[model samples]
Target chain A: MTVAADQPTALIRLGRFLRDNPVIPLILLLFVLIGVLEYMRPGIVNERWIGNTIKFAIPLAMLAACQTITMLTGGIDLSVGVVATVSAFVVSSLTPLLGAPSAVTISLAAAVLVGLVNGFGVGICRVHPLIMTLGTGLIATGCLQVYQRFVIATGSEIPSFLEWLGTGRTFSLPNALFLFLPFAALILWGLARTGFGRLLYAIGANENAAKLSGVRSWQVFLALYTLSALIAGITGLLYVGMIRAPSLSLANPLLLPSVAAAVIGGTSIFGGRGGYSGTIVGALILTVLGTLLTLLQMPEGARRLLFGLIILAVTALYVRFTDQS
Target chain B: MTGFLKKHGWTLGLLAILLTLLIAIRVVQPNFGASGLESLARAALPFAFATAAMAVVVIAGGIDLSVASMMAVTGVTAAVLMDNATEGQAVFAVIAVLLVGIAMGAINGALIVLTKVPDIVVTLAMLFVWEGVALLILSTPGGGAADWLRSIIAGPVSLPFLPEAWTFWLPNAFIFMAVAIAVIWLPLRRSKLGLSIYAIGSDDTAAFRSGIAIGRTRVAAYAVAGLFCALGGLSLTMGTGIGEPVPGPYLMASVAAVVLGGVVLGGGRGGLLGPIIAVFILRAIRLLLTLMAVDPNVTTIVEGTIMVVVVMLGAILMMRERRS
Candidate 1:
């Protein structure tokens, strides 16, 4: 009888723990998926696979960071992909004309300009974030197309530093970790410990309340979008280094995946309840899933279909388990 | 006159903008004639349908990013099924495609309702799914519709015993759009479901408190939007005489049109007429730009700028009203 009573208590405690910490299950799910992959192909979970997954996943997670941060404020940065593309394309196109450093600076500045436009639209004009970002993204793409004509004669080149940082490996780990570790740590720390971070959560939870409390919400929005764009720009530079080519639509494919990563990581689209730690894991899961899909040898169409279906299934299951409402 | 102006102020403003655009196009290209107008109608039909579909979903407090993909899927499916088929078979294929579109949309609605996931997330996933399906149906855009179907959709209006010039002013595509609007939108707007859609969009809790079935109405809105998307697909296939599995450009254009037409993003306050007019205005602007020999890339820039300016103007007006 004592044993039976103890068993119920233990089960209840486990249940309570899960209810409190939702990311725990997501981590477990990631592991289960990995285990399944390993089961399907023995010895495929080696150091090289790990390095490659991280190499690709780092850029995606970086892009998703923009979504995570913006989503916290009940908005999204649809311009992130375009911003990344512009930064990548500009840097590549300008490197041959100017030095790498100036090219990088100018590319990032361009991203900042786009972000400011987004901020102005969202914060001051009160345009919906989706529409504002979408419009700005279109304008940026058009400008990039125009800019391409001027730089077409110059050709493109990736900076050596970015190439080293993107594709290099050290002791079975991706060199990207050198950049990503500090970046992730800062985001995690900032989101938790900083007043600005708290402001994001507050605004997302209740914008009117945040405004009533003297938050200067528009200023927050301006700063927030600029920071998001800056991150996307950085991700673009790193991504171009990894891919070793920058084109007009270089980062477009990553847009939906980044959004998916944020959503799957439990970053609520409605806003105010998520973190970067989960998004990092979400990116890893996607990379692994992509690997598995490749191994399955399915056609592109089937792979995409399964990819979408799996994302939907995982998100649905996750919400069902974690959501009290 | 005052009451009329008060009621249709936004529509009148949109019409004025459209008129200015047309005049600019005419001035830029002196030979802009009946054939040009017919081609413009032909080119704008698919997008008009897409904008209408997007407008409905946005007005219902949910957005279907998959509408463009849905159009692609339905278009390709119809094309593949109708290829070299008998007239009856082609008609049957069209019906089948419509049903498939409805089923796809209803599935979208059911998933959102069942999973309680946000509409954007679910629809985003569905966008990929539908695109994949389109790719599956037509791997590389090599499918054709029935000949008669294409003629009916893409051909000029030619009434028996009427002069060619007189009848050429009205393209069959425009008639299709009109018939669609009359047969679908007008009646639906007067129905109870339409009221519930607007009700839920404005305030779901209040709507629910008043005993409106929010879930069902939202689902209906999606279903109706899906039908419009299917119509869009049919128009595309018929106009082009083939299916193209690309939906990205169309998606952007449709969304821009919806916003340009004065539809509020959050929902509950918009109509089809404004978006239809916006479509023509957009087409006219592009035509004007082309006639002026501006770089094609500049058109994208101008479109984006116009969208931003229009929304900013609307927001400012709303602010003034609220202040007063």
Candidate 2:
């Protein structure tokens, strides 16, 4: 349908404005925040710092896209961090078996299976999203640990392909960015262009109404959860390729970066509203903010407190200004 | 029997477990003896503080996953304050830590109440914030506590009367819990604010219509939870003899204990007594694994597995009741 034809009446005109205008303000906000930081310190936009910001943004970029996909259907996969962990371990284990190609396939397959199970458990069983995913995420990590300890062994793994994944780049861009091309294009097309994309927004907007209006409820649930898992799995596997192990293989605590990344990206926690496009922006903002703070040698724990405070503040503002309910 | 089972259910099951494990220990090491009763006091102490803290939030139908980080933050801050402060200043640091808990928690409550944001999300954000702070401050996994404080907390306290042999095996944390239970729990239970905490959790709109201040109650509930978390954090500070950034397991472990104590996650139900027992039972599992000399990795696996089973069991029980 034509853009004008698809536009809603006066009631929804404001929504369309929001959906369209959200990104510009966000990008501007980033610039403004950066400008202030730079003014205070001067030269944050220097070439080297810019380069570092891109590098910093890569991992979170992978995470945001993954998180955004699931969030589109109104769910958050707490397992993304663990998925990063499992992928790393699998890569380390598989490198010597049939080489990286086979290992990559195994990792992807595992992610698909996990995604399916997560989808089915959440969508069909109708378990609370947080608990279902948390339970499964725990089990996945435990099994990985079991495999790491007894089955495979856990230690330093600098698998050859992993180095390529983590460090490889073309000209100036990360090779990981290349991996996201298919995901970004597919997601943009699926969510914004295709019938299924419309279905997802519809489902997210109101699951009951969507179902009553002929949406295949369970199928939609299955699709969103699975898609969310697949994206996370890809990010995880790619991360392993980069780091040569799971993110958790290094054991940075599972606080709420991925979750916050999604939220800060402007994805609604209540569901039925969000875009991966904004998630990318949010992740970038976070990386820059983090790096800048790190430069001053601020205590790491202090940053977490700040991160939490910001989320609370942003959420409060969004609710007051936007929700008013 | 069922009535008794329902009332004393979580408590009975947990005590049975504690007895069986202690008996098992008696058989295994025989002289793994009464002197070791200190282990129970220390083991249960941190969770006792956390679970009580969590009870308030849960009473308002919210959860504070950040308690561990708060625990770590408090632990780290307490350690830092110990070195610089005069005795008087050290006392202020302790109070300061509790205030931080209350403040951190109040933020969660207010955010959830005002934005109608989910408790899970707000707490999740707080979780990150707290842990990140812990990471920067501690830097390393941990550092040692003040000598005087550790000695008093870890050392035995003698009572006056019959003999030194008749003394209770009370750790400082256990004593703290006793004082907190009296100061925090007793009046809280009988307060109008306390009853309203349950009311809001059970049904916010209904509570509001009945003239309860839903928003304020929720905020107060989470704030109060913060206070308990600070105490729990203090216990962690005491038990570990210092601050360590690795409070993740303790946090989740307390959650499992809270769940076991028959305090359902959805709130407006369950009691502090339930979580206390669950925490003790969970600690016994770790203790059992220690006695078995099972790998720490294996212990982690068991902890996660047990958590899933218990949660699933609770869900199943709920569904069964709903179906019937």
Candidate 3:
């Protein structure tokens, strides 16, 4: 507490350091490089670009935040991508009857339920989160396929009001964007100050030690997993709003990038460290990378290849920069 | 039987699931009687190879999510080469594919050693890279295979008294996999290097203090994993007779299958054969469901649920073991 009180000055210095980190340049790097590559191309960062970027970023950002928290607690919710797929399948399938709000509520519930199962398995059952989540992810994806085939039927788009949640902008900003950054901040605060969040970190750092010290390590882990699933729910709904539809493959490719963003943002997979703030940077950087790749007209294969390389590079950088011990 | 049950409680339990699945298969279609057994063993091969690949690296306390992608990449290489290669060149392609697996695995080890990045991160990256490369190499759904290669993949072992009653009774994938099992498990159990693999997995720094070169050991494990993946690719191509780019997602699923089969995720524990049982169980269940005419979509959900149940059950078992 004494150090923490005096650490605001230190926090400020750290913030300044982060501001000067290569990631800062990384965020800008995509825009400049894309600008030069697409030279004389109209509307790169104009209203259309801004609109798509913000709307597209919402679901991804939420996913990043969810993964960030899991990483904070020394876990990674591999199930998030498939959870999003399952939730989208649920809500999008129900939109015709429940209207937008009710549909979203139902979908979010399903997402959380899936997350809770993951949390239960990992935190309560003490299964490795990666393997447990991987299994849950498969179940969710399978459920998504079933729901898409049965409940959703093919070729159905979400109702109009549903789309507006992601599409409608405030003061010329996307509604999804406005909500995305605030949600990240709130989660970041919880991680920094809340007892629950601290308990999570303590568990991640050293589970046996945390248990010895009287932390309910399992419960804290359970909560972190639930939060991760909850974020996935929110992301799925946002995706429905933006895309107005769902399919078997809707969130299939999301697993790699979501994980990459969190890890690149400096969240350690081994547990007990990292923050969501870096995750946002990681997400933004990835967003820019994707955006640039599309503008460059690269094949899906090459783009994916670059995607893999970037993840390796950033992780290597993180390992070099941080002292894992 | 009770003595058998006591010594092999988990194995017996797995056998129970396997028996139920076999009975279910017999009920679904009578053809499942004989072919079903052969099919179970055959279908189990690729996943077992993939699992073995996954197990090694995981035993070293790292993961390689790219196994499926590398499988695809290697499969693509084999298909393309086998299509055009001469007899000598076919031999060269085999060597090349194995090398690709090793190089890929080595890259994972290098990144892990030098950067201290997590395996999940590095392997996830490689997943993308490999998937992209595979897609580029084979853009469409269909591809070619050598005629001679198909017969071997499609044929069975020459076991004694097993008449040539369609050796289609035993697919070559099973043969390839049986070879891998003995080759890997025997050495792993008896070798110092293999023992060190378990040691590093339990705690790396301690292993380092104990004179294990953690970096080199991990790197070697990953390389071995890559080679197994390559073998899986060859077997998959031979079994199916085509190289499809679709199964890349199944690589991680295979990893999960291994983990589900009682292999520890962070390494140091579990055996090669345990997960091999899981591979057989999963494939048999999937095949039986198909025979039962369940919707493919629902079948996926069923698979997922089974995985969860397995992991959850495994957890409970481990907890009990720890308590005991």
Candidate 4:
């Protein structure tokens, strides 16, 4: 029996390329999907549609970035959505009293605090990431609901600056697109080029080995979770900006889909492998998928079904590829 | 006694905590008598069954996020089927629902085993799929369970000789739990396959080297989990007396119940009893908050805080045990 490795044929080379450059295939998939959508709906080819797609995709992309970093470390943050909501809620509440700058500062600080708590639980206390984050998320949400129900019956206002950032346009392009480009680049470079990124991959790939090699695993986890929480908070702020109002329901729906987006982008949920580059594309794919479903006049049920199938298929492909190597 | 206590110390501690909470509730609402208890039992049944379903999969070292979605699928199926059927066909309809649940679970098991996908990811994706499927089957919830099924599941059964006020005058939910533990958990826990499930959970490589079929065991565990999820779905149907389109927040709630029960998420560390006890404890917490005039939000906040505190305490206990 001849081994494929011994003589690399065209098929083998193509397979190797697909395996090595997962982002390539992901980008291809995105373009192909866009092209199909464009053909189906001519309006999809316009700048307005492009702006709308990017506008909707921004929050998911930001949330996916958080999920990517945490997942790369072999943990997940289910609390990202709630943390974001709490932080945004805090920002909204404070804006009336503290003004825009201070409220934003306080909002980001609130997010950092949530992240720190998550990190402490997962790291110092040795709770599972899922449980720790989940517990914290629940507590935060419960607090929010209580505040809304009893403490404050009325809603808070969104700062104009945030609204502009969230829904503003520059040169006929969504401002969010500009914001995402740099954010994506920073993360993509950090994951691929920075020492912190290497440590993240090392921890995800093998925590014990990393720990033995002098990496303070707990510290790394603390930082990573904090960063994830901060990202979630920022996403919430951006989301509120886009809609020009705060919503309780915004975060819950984003939770599973953000996780889904990260996984779809080729990031391994188990950690170490995958990149933010793929995740950006993944967020785009999800947005396109939602649009396509709506355009097709399919109900939310069909969209969810397709979402599940896509996640399963992408995950299965990654699994198959990784297994062979 | 010391040795036995050391081995089962966590179990005893959990039981103690449960008792303390129950007593506290009774003290707060002294008038919450047997009927209150009955209502609590009825409310706890669906979640108890959910926790049991989770326990089976978690014990086998696999997590099934799809169980909530599975419950919805099965519930919708049962409701849709029975709503149109007469009294004679309700039994067959239920059988069909159970079979569908088992089949869905088997598929999850098969996908995990064959594709080598992580259990969390596979089940997470399936959660979406099943939920979507449920929605597709019944866009709007308009179906109902048969009268007999509801009465049997939610109604209390009288002990022929017992007074109506006696505590032993059991709700059918309690009977359901007893029969489930007897018919499903007890035999399964003692069986060769059950042992294999644990073996694989603890160390799949070792289990395989010892001649256990990893694939078969995992599939069986998931299949069994599916059966329990189907039961949970039925309980939901009976509780509501109708097919509800929205599954609400039971997915995370069930996972929370399992964790509160002290079942290790990565598997192989807990048993069936903890989850069952934990489910009741959770219900009591919700009930306690409601009784205390606490806002719904406050109740959830309190619940989350309690869960975190308990889990942290559990971790502390384990750490201490390790040190000693």
Candidate 5:
């Protein structure tokens, strides 16, 4: 009788825990999806598969970091994809001539320059983030094309360190975790604990109010975009290492998916809410879904159609559930 | 004069820029003639229509990233239906294609309303969905258009009773553009739905409090945008005489045109006329770049730079005006 009475309290406690942490449901959903994938193809969810999934998902999650941080300020960085491509292309082409370290440094610097321009446009000039980033992205693409002409004669080389981090495995676990874990922990900690991070939320929630409270919103924007672009540059390096190829459009395909991941992870596009923890789960979910689609052997068109449908469905359901309790 | 300038300064500024570009083209290519203008008009039809579509939705405080995909889908649908068809059948095919576009747009509107998803996310999803559908319709970039339909859209106007000088420089596409403006834009501008769109975009809560049907008006705005996209697709079909599954450079170009045209991105402050003119300006810039024999890669840089400069100028102007 005492055990039966305690069971009701435990059930209530679990329910309260889930309600307090919405990310729990998403986590549960991720596991459910993995189970479905395993059931579909018996023994497919092995250590190797897990490593590959994490390997591919890292670049995407890193790119999504740009979106999540920007979206927190009620803005977006549409140029992140191009930034990644530029970084990857530049680093690869320069590695042959400048050595890997300096090439990586210069490529990251280029990304910072682009980010500075974006920040100036959005923060100082008061241009909308979408237009500012789009214009900057276009300019970057154009610059890349011109740069390509000069670099066409030179061969590209992926940096050895990046390659190891991107593709190497340690005890059946991805080596990328060495990089990602620290990066994610820093972001999570920074966002939750730092005054600068709180400023982002304040500015996103209401710029005027934040300004009234002496937030210096423009400075925040400047730093935020610069940091976001730097992250994108890092993602590019890792992506090139993983794919072992660099092209003008290397990271373009991940652009929309990154945004979707952030949105699915419960970051409000309008801003003022959400955390990096949810976005990490979101990235994992998309990677698993991609694997499932590939295993289904569907045509490209059907694959895209289903991908869109599932994102829509998942976002809708996620929103519905979260909104209620 | 100051009052007049204050009222129409933006339009006048745009016109001056356009004239400068045209003059520059004339100076660069001494042989630039009526035929060159005609060809430019023909080339610009698709962009103008597409920009108009973007502008309308943007004015309603939403962005549809799928406009280019919608154009591709509708264009391919038209191509498949009108291939080898007679004149009457081609007309039917045209109407059906437009309906298809409107239907697709309505679905977008309904989904956004029902799901409470942000406009950008829903449209972003639809961008892939529609592109996928386009691929399914034409696995490759190959589909035919009716001969008469092509001639009507892209052919030169040749009125037998008119003077050769008057008729030779006119493109049939220009007439279609004028008809579309007359039939769609002007009426929509003066309609209640149009006012509601502006109202909602400017302030949805206030609009809701004022008893405006936000959902229906938003749907109508999207549907109108879809119709314009259909027109753009039809222009593409006529210009190319075939269906192309890929959207090409039109998507970014359309958005750039909208922003450059002085329409505020958050909506409710711009007009279609500005964007239409902006399209010609963009085309003229391209033509000038080509005439100057600049590297094609550099042309994109120039275009993007010009976009940034123009918007920056607009921002500065607004700031000054506000201060004064």
Candidate 6:
């Protein structure tokens, strides 16, 4: 009270402003990082580099977007990567037989089924999200592995349309951005303007209280988790389009990175705070870091080490701000 | 009968499951003899240790996502240290690796306490950090453990008069499990630190108000968990005779075993025997599938289904208990 009433100095106000808005510092830090990288590598910010970064970051951004939703529920979807892989596998396998439209539909349906199972296990049965998703992921991966036997025998091909989707550009924008931007907008609006969005925040903040307040928490969780999985399916399709080939390892590496991105972007892993706005920036920061490190010629081990350290630093920073205010 | 079952339902249930699976295996293949059991035990032992490592932390109301990576690190450490060391030095090197495990665990505990970061986040990062460290130490996994370590971990040690016909050859995993339970887990369960861990897990605020040192106990639990993880890594080293950097699947498998063993994810509600039995049951399921010539792909599906079922059962049981 005393501090607020004192009419603080400009420097103090600036400090408070920076402290209150964590995203600005991140944006500034990203710019500084970009500047440093560009200084080291002259063509670091070229159109080609920018295009590739967006291409690489698209799948991650999608994953991070959905992960933000799940995290807002105070739960995580560890199966996101596996579901995406399954979707890609489905798309690749069925493209020859069903063509693009039906294959994409069937693949997303499978993703939704898997998500529903995860939701039932987590929401209805009240299993921990970590364990529930792990089981579902294992199941999905296992089924895919069995399915791979047939896929190997049949020799599936990536649809030409998907190849275009993966690598195509439209009006000087990467094709992936065209798919991701509107979806991101929908998610952002849903989080901000919808009753379900408020309910998600309520459930995450305190499930019991939400229940007492007449929130059908399970139904919300089911929708949230299913939505997350469907988005993962979309990510997988886009991934298949981008890479032009689908392999088992397609989305495996992105699982942790997606979570890390969300956390970095200011989404509280504990839930009920954060938005897609922060996550988009978070995803971009990670992509920028990856690009910078690659340009710098760092070894994989050093890259991972630096990655872990940065996540730790950002998490600690976030935790401090959340705790303070 | 009801009273006994009520008091030890999870234990009895797990034992019964194990027995039924074994019987099913025997009925399917009468000639599936001691060697099969030996291999099964061998494959399952490392997992059993990993499960124990997880049980310790989970029981303390914390989780260690890094144990699997720690196993890789410990394996890499042993392999690198024993590269040119002689027989006498190898034994000391194993001991040093164990200390390193404890030290790593202590660091995890200390960070959780000092920073007040959730254990899951800290250990999750450590999972990647440890894996990176492991890779840096040995990029492609081509180092060996000492000969004595191998014999100690893998050499035959069957019970007397058990069977000369079927040749009931007990692998060293049994001894490791026994030592882990008898020498480590049981004693720890009786110690003050153990009680403190339980108290904290059950209710931290109440425990703190009751004069228990929350930070120290939590750290001790994690350190103990780390000790088991080190053992797990050693077991891995002995089994493979080389360090391997991939510990991802093992991490998931261990968590599955822990849950299957009836250890609640939230903590303070289960014991070691259940997890030990769960490990064997999972291994048996895999072994049975392999023996039946079932596709290995199908085995993964089965593993996932069983994990979900076991956890669902546990959840139902908890709900019933709460309702009653």
What DockQ does each listed candidate score? 0.75, 0.40, 0.69, 0.79, 0.65, 0.68
lDDT of 4 by residue, A92-188 (tens): 7778777888989988987888899899888877888888888999998987786666426434778887888888899778887667788888998
Worst 10-residue lDDT window, candidate 6 chain A: A1-10
Compose the digit string of candidate 4's lDDT tens values, residues B206-285: 99999999999999999998998888888888888777655657677777878888788787778888778888888888
Tens digit per residue, CA lDDT, model 3, A48-69 = 6667666665677678877777
- Two-chain complex of model 1, DockQ on C-alpha atoms against the true structure: 0.75
Scored by TM-score, the top model is 1
Report the C-alpha lDDT of model 2 over A1-325, residue by residue, as the tens digit: 2464465464256445655556665687678768867877876677666655665576677667666766666766776667666766676676676577877778777767767766776676665566556666766776786677653443445466557756776666666666666767777777788887788778767888998899887787787777766666666666666654444454223225667767777777657777877777777778767765666666766766676777766655544434531
Could you give the TM-score of chain B for each candidate, in order? Answer: 0.96, 0.88, 0.88, 0.95, 0.95, 0.95
Best prediction by lDDT:
1
Select the stronger candidate by DockQ from 3 and 6: 3
Q: Considering DockQ, where higher is better, how would the candidates rank from best to worst?
A: 4, 1, 3, 6, 5, 2
True contacts kept of each: 0.63, 0.54, 0.91, 0.76, 0.59, 0.58
Count clashing residue pairs per candidate: 0, 15, 1, 0, 0, 2
Model 6 ranges with Cα > 4 A deviation: A1-20, B1-4, B158-169
**lDDT by candidate, in order shown:** 0.88, 0.70, 0.75, 0.84, 0.87, 0.84
Task: For each candidate, give its TM-score against the true structure.
Answer: 0.96, 0.84, 0.89, 0.96, 0.95, 0.95
Q: Ten residues in a row with the worst lDDT in model 5 chain B?
A: B147-156
- Residue pairs whose backbone atoms clash in candidate 6: A166-A241, A166-A242
DockQ top scorer:
4
Distance from true location, Cα of B139 in model 2, Å:
6.5
Compare candidates 2 and 6 on DockQ and give the better one. Answer: 6
Candidate 5's docking class is medium
Better of 5 and 6 by DockQ: 6
lDDT of 3 by residue, B41-107 (tens): 7667678888888888777887888888888877877777676667667777778878887887787
